[model samples]
Target: MKNVIITGTSRGIGLELVKCFAEAGHQVLALSRNSQPVSDLNLKQVTALSFNLAEATDFETVKAYVNTHWKQVDLLIHNAGALVNKPFSELTPADFQNVYTTNVFGVAELTRVLLPNMVKGSHMVTISSMGGIQGSMKFPGLAAYSSSKGAVITLSELLAEEYKDSGIAFNVLALGAVQTEMLEEAFPGYEAPTTAAGMASYIFNFSLTGSTFYNGKVLQVSSSTP
Candidate 1:
């Protein structure tokens, strides 16, 4: 069983990933700004940590926690992200900074601190949006979010190339529109058939095996695809 750490677990995909990993018999370290309602009274190996993930300081706390207890992480999914949907004209520097702090910088910082203890067979899963690759026409408010995720796509590709022989793998799940709290919050009119829990299951099952076919690869799952 692997030890998995996930941030932004209060709702949506992050919460789903947390439960999926726990069910798969892996030790799950869930960190978020809020609690997940304590669905299971019999909390086994699953742990929930709360933090403002965008803050740069969280990385050391996360790394220190693992170093003290588990000593290593088999998988680190940077699934916690924020969407700033606003017209570019109205987008302020603060808006971009806040989004980047959580979406890119925070994730990168956490990975850097954790990599020293992360071993072979370990994988990193980052959830990027199709907007990261293709700009969204229906939602112009997503400029900040789109640009931030775009950086993630580029970062993963470079990291994969750099660590090609390190026994470490990096991949991005460039998602289409999925039904989640964030989705509705960002785009209220979007119709989604797949929920966060379902997507979480897909991510967990997909990462179980080691496959370079999808490694260094950007896979997009969208509701608009045929």
Candidate 2:
């Protein structure tokens, strides 16, 4: 019954999240660079858009959709992410820029554009990574990706405090390894303890109810250590 917005819905966890919300009978706005996959699903009450988080024009499209269609957004999930797996010495400035653009900057810009449509009690759930956690564990090749994730964690905290009186909640979920295409591309041959559908289900439930107990908090949803 709620109007929900989910980004990165082309494949992996994002794709599963779209299914979870649609099957639950929620009105879903699924955004991704390649929207055809979600378009092919043809789920009732689901609208898939070819959206690029890194592009400012796409945000305008989302604003138009929200203004024209949904009166309010009950939940916004920042599930889109970009990763570059290369040694620090080989990493270029453009590498960091691209990762930050999609992961950090995009999340901020999209939230800004959607803020007016999100009423009191709305929840903004950002999908972060355990690698982003300070003093947890560090990997050599994830300098840009992990740093961008960390930036968002702080950004959510700041937003939660800034918008405390507004009644909107901002929280983060720092996830462990999941068996996703992104994982395969980053760390080949590694088997994860969780699946995309499993994580999606967890996130779906949390988005519905987590605001009651948490705001400006980062829950480390990991069964295994990184």
Candidate 3:
């Protein structure tokens, strides 16, 4: 069984992912600002860690814990993100910084700290959004969120290329609208075609097979065909 580390495990897709991985017999480290929900699951082989991804300093605790317990992580999934839905004209500099701190900087910083624990054949996956990719439907109020996700995709590509010879794979999954609390907040009264559990299952399977068949690629997951 692989040792997996996933961020944003308090609710929605992140919580579902924790369930999927734990059910698959993997040792999972679930990180979230409020880890009580994950802890309440009481699943075997699952450990809950609390930390705010938007705060860079909070990762020191994670680094310390990982360094003490885990020798290596087989799978690392960056699923935590911040969405600030505001028109460009109304968006402030703080809005971009806040979004990027969680969506992009957090991923980079965590990976950097955990690099030593990622051996050959390990995999890193970042969750992006369809809105971040070119030609995807762009909602006017999601500039900060979309731009940060776009940067995440680019960062994954660069890391993939950098680690190509080391046997470590990096990839991004650009997801379509999924039914989650975050989505409801972004688009009130609108229903998404995909559910968190469904997407979580897909992500769990991909984390297992993706490193072997794909590397440095962005795969889009959605129920709606375009």
TM-score (all chains, Cα) for each model: 0.92, 0.99, 0.97
CA shift of 37, model 3, Å: 0.5
Task: Write model 3 residue lDDT over 1-226, tens digit each, in one string.
Answer: 9989999999999999999999989999999999999999999999998888766777888778777888788999999989897789999999999999999999999999888889999999999998789878788899999889899999999999988998999999999889999998788877888899999999999999999999999998876621
Give each model's whole-structure lDDT. 0.79, 0.95, 0.90
Give Cα distance to truth, residue 65, candidate 2, Å: 0.3
lDDT tens per residue, model 2, 32-124 = 999999999999999999999878999999999999998799999999999999999999999999999999999999999999998899999
Q: Which ten residues in a row have the lowest lDDT in candidate 2?
A: 181-190
What lDDT would candidate 1 get against the real structure? Answer: 0.79
Model 3: CA > 4 A from native: none
Please give the distance, in angstroms, between residue 78's alpha carbon in candidate 3 and its true position after superposition. 0.3
Candidate 3: which pairs clash?
A: none
Ranking by TM-score: 2, 3, 1
Q: Which of the numbered candidates is closest to the native, going by highest TM-score?
A: 2
Taking the tens digit of each residue's C-alpha lDDT, what string does model 1 give over 88-186?
899999999999988998878888888887777788888888888854443578888988988999998988899888888888888877888778878
Model 3 error, position 28 (Å): 0.7
| Candidate 3 weakest lDDT stretch, 10 residues | 217-226
At residue 47, candidate 1 shows an lDDT of 79
